[model samples]
Target chain A: MSLGEFELIGRYFRSMELGNAGGSEHVTLGIGDDAALISMAPDKQLVVSTDTVVLGTHFPPDYIPANLAYRALAAAVSDLAAMGARPLSFTLALTLPEVDETWLQSFAQGLTDAARDHRISLIGGDTTRGPLNINVTVLGEVRPRNVVRRGDAQPGDLLCVGGPLGDGGGGLAVVLGESMPSSVSDAARDYLFQRFWRPLAQCELGLELAGVASAGLDVSDGLIADARHLAEASGVALHIRLADLPCSAALQAWPEAQRMEWMLGGGDDYVLLFTLPVASIRCLEVWASQGFDVTVIGEAVVGSGIWLDDGQELKEKVQPAGYQHFQRKSND
Target chain B: MSLGEFELIGRYFRSMELGNAGGSEHVTLGIGDDAALISMAPDKQLVVSTDTVVLGTHFPPDYIPANLAYRALAAAVSDLAAMGARPLSFTLALTLPEVDETWLQSFAQGLTDAARDHRISLIGGDTTRGPLNINVTVLGEVRPRNVVRRGDAQPGDLLCVGGPLGDGGGGLAVVLGESMPSSVSDAARDYLFQRFWRPLAQCELGLELAGVASAGLDVSDGLIADARHLAEASGVALHIRLADLPCSAALQAWPEAQRMEWMLGGGDDYVLLFTLPVASIRCLEVWASQGFDVTVIGEAVVGSGIWLDDGQELKEKVQPAGYQHFQRKSND
Candidate 1:
């Protein structure tokens, strides 16, 4: 017999723990009894964030359900990454048009694997009939060390990105008819595809950079728009050294125009865009031995508006400034 | 000329703050920020919970969109009520099919009203196109004081519900074609309909009964199902008194069979269902004089299963229970 939703969660979704809580902090609890108990911490503060991914909006139609599930968790985890909050747990609200057993098995397996990897529990959520949608709420804790905000960037702070800019957008291009991954070579294409589908939440980087990173946000809405947001919020001008933006081997192999488009306008890369004090650039190098390094792209200056240093008066109309639904479909 | 989603949120959704964070020594920063910063007393901990409501699944299809928004937030707030936690703040993930200008205005108005009424801030969330679904993650504070669990009920404890039962379900009867609201006329019918749509989260009662109530939960599913859950978790049996089950004036006037169905099977009444120490009932009565009242409907015993005092047997004819959406529709 096929297991019920409750039974499915009971067997696979329980027992995972995230945050220092590890299911012990008393702040949050997962499925088991009638209700979960949470014991608030004394010195630490709590940060809560939520995100939802509809089937065709956040992901491609051809995207596998398991991959979609992992990406859903990652999307919310990305919020924690932005807040420098150690995730305690997450509740998933999954709505599906149908309960295909095989699809559910794959989806639950992916959800369980991702939760275990992040140590976040599937506390409690609901399932219902609807078009495919997954809403995830992540509970996290922050220390006084820092809960980074987008408004904290100073005029002279160095603007940087934790990782690459637009592989997801490029991978999406490959998913649609506009581009071919084979153009970037098989292995590199595979790398970009996976990165686009199951982007990692840079939790460790967020925690480590909390004190040093002055202003930060997760790069869900293409780099240009998100960076514009950072600058607008911080009341500063952001200049991008098109040469300084990170890229994947696949993107490097693309034509200069195409590669730059992905970096500037692609969404769902799940990387961190942050700024740090100009003096901290030296500290960044000292921490480079930890296998993490960010290239300083520019500095925050007094003013607003983004500058593209590619020596072009225009570049594909700035990809219409992030993917807004009902505005238009993406052609990247 | 109407504001876009981002503009609407920026202009109106900002400046939302829960009482002053500076007034409390534990709160570091209140609202108008990415996340509210809070410090817990060395002895106190935080409780986090989430709840979701869909347009058609949790509420009637024809209910006003604004009322649905209000009720969705309340459903989630009720989780704090069950945990005996003080409401801090909540984040909302609202999914809608199309951006109806009038609908968005009404929905936001309802959301703001509910947040203001509850003294909780709308921290941050996402907006997207899909079936209408509202998911809220509520964060509250609690002491080590036995953070009530469904498993903690003792044999001699009194099964108490914070308020009357069945009004919500009876209201649903009026909503669906099942029955009419003959009991409560006109505006009162609208009131019952609103209550069924968005019942008040019993945060006050939860806080008052914290140390005294051994086990507690919010009754989203009917009394029988939720009671069965409490009994199973507490490792005891429950004998519910039909005579003692608190009935509202609206429900009391309904036909006996209809009321029974509504009270025992209808869900979405966010009242606190808990078992209190018999001795604490007196203290509870004292608080009742102040505002909140506790009604004893049954007793927990050293056995398993649920029994109704009506002297009739409950036979399980159907395998499935509340809020089911498992099977795929043939139409789909």
Candidate 2:
């Protein structure tokens, strides 16, 4: 049966209990009128980020709808985490070639699960008929002084990552049917696939490191590539110790060179990469003790560009070989 | 030369003087970061809305880039206007099939013009490779008590419109090469085309009507259809006088039947439709004197659905025949 826009929304999205709909302190209005009304704490500032994921480009055309929805939201919310902002609400502007009720149902379920995981409400959205694309604009709040910026890292600051790298890339390979060696177990494959489909946003870690991290951003692009952004923004050089880069067991199962490539150049990790003063190392340890998985991978120095130290020698410069959208091969 | 996503954004969108960059009280941080930071007055509530306009569906494939961008932003910002909120900032998530530098430049120029006209900043955005789609999320601020809701119109409230109707539909017809009668002058055609390309959002009027309007919304989806939404929300019947609809002279140049159809069933007008207490007629007149063209169309009554009064007889029922995304014929 063909569903009109309102009926489709009413049947799947509007009826779902995604939180903060009827009686929310901050969300005065949600998902019914022309706009959504929200109120933040007196001392808080609003933070917003938008991300778009397209079929065939961001994911395989046949990818599961639920997982695609979850990943789309996770990627958008990761920006909020990068800003050290508390997730409040998000609006999804979804375009579909056709309305498949079953696909929409699964997508909505996944979106609801993601919303619950991120502790954010679905405030308002627009659905249109077009190529399959999901654009999520996430709203968050943070105390002005506590917010982290990408351009504040000073020389002699320690560079850190919130989680392991390369799992996302490895998972993508697995999803694309890359043949694994006999050493790769089912558990490892499952772990990597989970990482690809449900890369967690480091919200709690970001909030905790608000005053500690001098410069920060989420690693949507590859670690080495995204690190250059921080370095350029802060006008400092990042010296990354190649051996110190964190890797999940699933990623480590691959060849050392492949794992290293993924570690340095895999995109969609959604891990927070940040810079903190040497004096804040103690705070990092404290955060680690409190269940925040942070790994010190490098240092910021008074220079330019990214330098790779492989324990023996320091590589002069590194290229940002992350996934560039328009530069990629056409899906056609 | 093919442009990477970052390079394309930096070359066109980022460098544009769309407003509220470098130094703005509300926009603490604009583009180039993970998210945008905005702070509003303590007494104001935040209003937000998202809209997605897709190529081949919302606009023709060969539509001018600048006009398309302007119209997209205007449509999204119109939601803020409908909520009686002051425009602040917006984020754009644009998906394109390919990177065309010339098209990008033109689109950016149009977007810049729209942002300047609306007095809103392009704080953040995302660019991805996909079918052409523009999703804009707009944020605004309004005093809590002054906000107009769709569910608050009393039975005796007078229904009013902020501006002329049917011009948008008439303009769309012009754009689609609809042959007008010989009597339709060139000036009228030019006016209609302009109306289609640059439908102004009644933001100032919405803000002015905040306390005066009991209930309100923008007329995006035809008059009778959208009026039904207001009626349903208010739990009252809207009795609209067909002859009382404010139509532009350009639209009036069409045949009477065609003009009536366009007036009753045209979409994308982006004008404000509201209900006010009879005691506020003086306020309406005062607003009219100040260049806010508001016309009283009918009244709300204790019933359900929409009742049309054509001066001769009252039509008991009317079907909503607005533009619906998925239900329409496939572009394929």
Q: Please name the candidate that would achieve the greatest TM-score relative to the true structure.
A: 2
Candidate 2 lDDT over A155-203, as tens digits, reads 9999999999988778888888788787998999999888999878999
Candidate 1 at residue B325, lDDT? Answer: 18
Q: Which stretches of model 1 miss by more than 4 angstroms?
A: A1-5, A15-28, A33-35, A39-41, A310-332, B1-3, B15-38, B57-61, B177-184, B310-332
Model 1, position A251: C-alpha lDDT score: 81
Clashing pairs in 1: A17-A119, A18-A119, A26-A38, A26-A39, A27-A38, A27-A39, A39-B46, A40-B45, A40-B46
Off by over 4 Å in 2: A1-5, A17-24, A310-332, B1-5, B17-24, B310-332
Highest DockQ against the true fold, candidate: 2
lDDT of 1 by residue, B205-277 (tens): 8888788799999887777767877888889888889878777776666667667666776666778899988
Model 1 lDDT at residue A92:
76
Candidate 2 whole-model C-alpha lDDT, 0 to 1: 0.81
lDDT per residue as tens, model 1, A1-332:
12254455445445443322243444355665433555555556766677887755445566777787887888788878887777777777777776676787778777876776666667766665667768887777787767887888988898888888778777776655465635567787678767866788888788877878999987776787678778878888887788788887778877777676778767678888899898787867765777775667877877776766753322323334333321322111
- Weakest 10 consecutive residues, lDDT, candidate 1 chain A? A323-332
Question: Per-residue alpha-carbon lDDT of model 2 for B2-32, expressed as tens digits?
Answer: 3344575666877653343321458889888
> lDDT: which candidate is best?
2
Interface DockQ of candidate 1: 0.39
